[model samples]
Target: MTTYNLARYPERLAVVQLGPGSEVPSWAESSSVFSITATSTETSIICASRSVPAKTRHHRPYTAFAVVPDEGSADFDIASGVTGVLVALLTPLADAGVSVFALSTFGTDWILVHESDADRAEEAWRRSGHTVAPATPA
Candidate 1:
């Protein structure tokens, strides 16, 4: 089984959607937890701090948790057609009645659990035999 170290972000986040031509807000660029996905039709931006303007369509007050391997260890390497990795992680959270908003990149996965459920989510992962640790400095 793969071991995961989870890091909880301190600030609140917002998921904002804007038209393709709209520029990303300047505040988003400097956010501690910022992610933007753009396409021809629309753009989605997840910002760690600050509120979106009233005109922007957005969901707010979400919390982010990063699931990474221990420091100095190799990444999980799930890019090579691997399976059951995410399912294993998420099943416990679901069983604990925690809903997740997940994002994946080549190296690690980020799960956004509602702020109210953060504690329960962490407890669920722990009970499932995963090691949860504070994020080490990069």
Candidate 2:
């Protein structure tokens, strides 16, 4: 597996599940990094936990990490694509029994896990020869 640096984002996040075709909520705009995915079954939003409304159907307290790209290069999206990148990265965490929530942008890969497992996840990445950096708050 190719070793990559993982940078932690300092925010407790929530994954909200809304009915299909739901519009992206205004609250999500405040997040430094958030994603909205709509599928036939549901529309899911991953945003800062503090932004979610009280009645929202959501899961919370997730800590996030982003794959650090090589300096002067965005080649993080190699021929194999982000899926391949995530597969390589997720293996270590999975082996350690850490549940993860994953997302991707046009060229970046993200990894999220319950904050309770943050330390374990970092250790797993470190054991696999990846550098897990300290959280950088936005």
Candidate 3:
């Protein structure tokens, strides 16, 4: 597999869950990197650069890494038919002993690591021959 370029989002992110019938929260829209997934049973929102308010009734917060390629438009596409792409991208982190939580949409994937592991994770990706840069504005 070819080496992939990556950008690290400056914001700290959280993954939150709300009831299926609940309205989208106002904060979600303002997030730098936001993704919403809804199903009959529940809704999951990934909010970057901000944390869901403690008062908001939701699942526990999970810190995110919010990585993507450096050269594409915000909605960069990853070929679904490609094999081992994710494995190649994540192997470095695994070798560095950093665990991750991953979320993927049609166009790209976002890998979430604990807030405490962010620095090490970034370093690991860099060491693995991947270029890691600061994320560009949306």
Question: Which portions of model 1 miss their true places by more than 4 Å?
Answer: 71-81
RMSD of 2: 2.2
Which model, 1 or 2, shows the larger TM-score? 2
The candidate that wins on lDDT is 2
**Poorly placed runs, candidate 3 (over 4 Å):** 49-51, 57-80
TM-score of each: 0.81, 0.87, 0.75
Report the lDDT of model 2 for residue 75: 52
lDDT digits (tens) for residues 9-111 of candidate 2:
8889999999999998888744656888899999999888987888989998899999888777555656644345777789999999999998877667889
Q: Please, what are the lDDT tens digits per residue for candidate 3 over residues 1-138?
A: 466766676666777778997788787744555778889999888775355788765443345544464464543454335556578778988988888878776666778777788789878877777777777776
lDDT of each: 0.76, 0.85, 0.69
Number of colliding residue pairs in model 2: 0
Question: Candidate 1 on 21-70: residue-level lDDT in tens?
Answer: 67887766444467888899999898864656766687777888887755
| RMSD, one per candidate, in order | 2.4, 2.2, 3.5
* Count of residue pairs whose backbone atoms collide, per candidate: 0, 0, 0
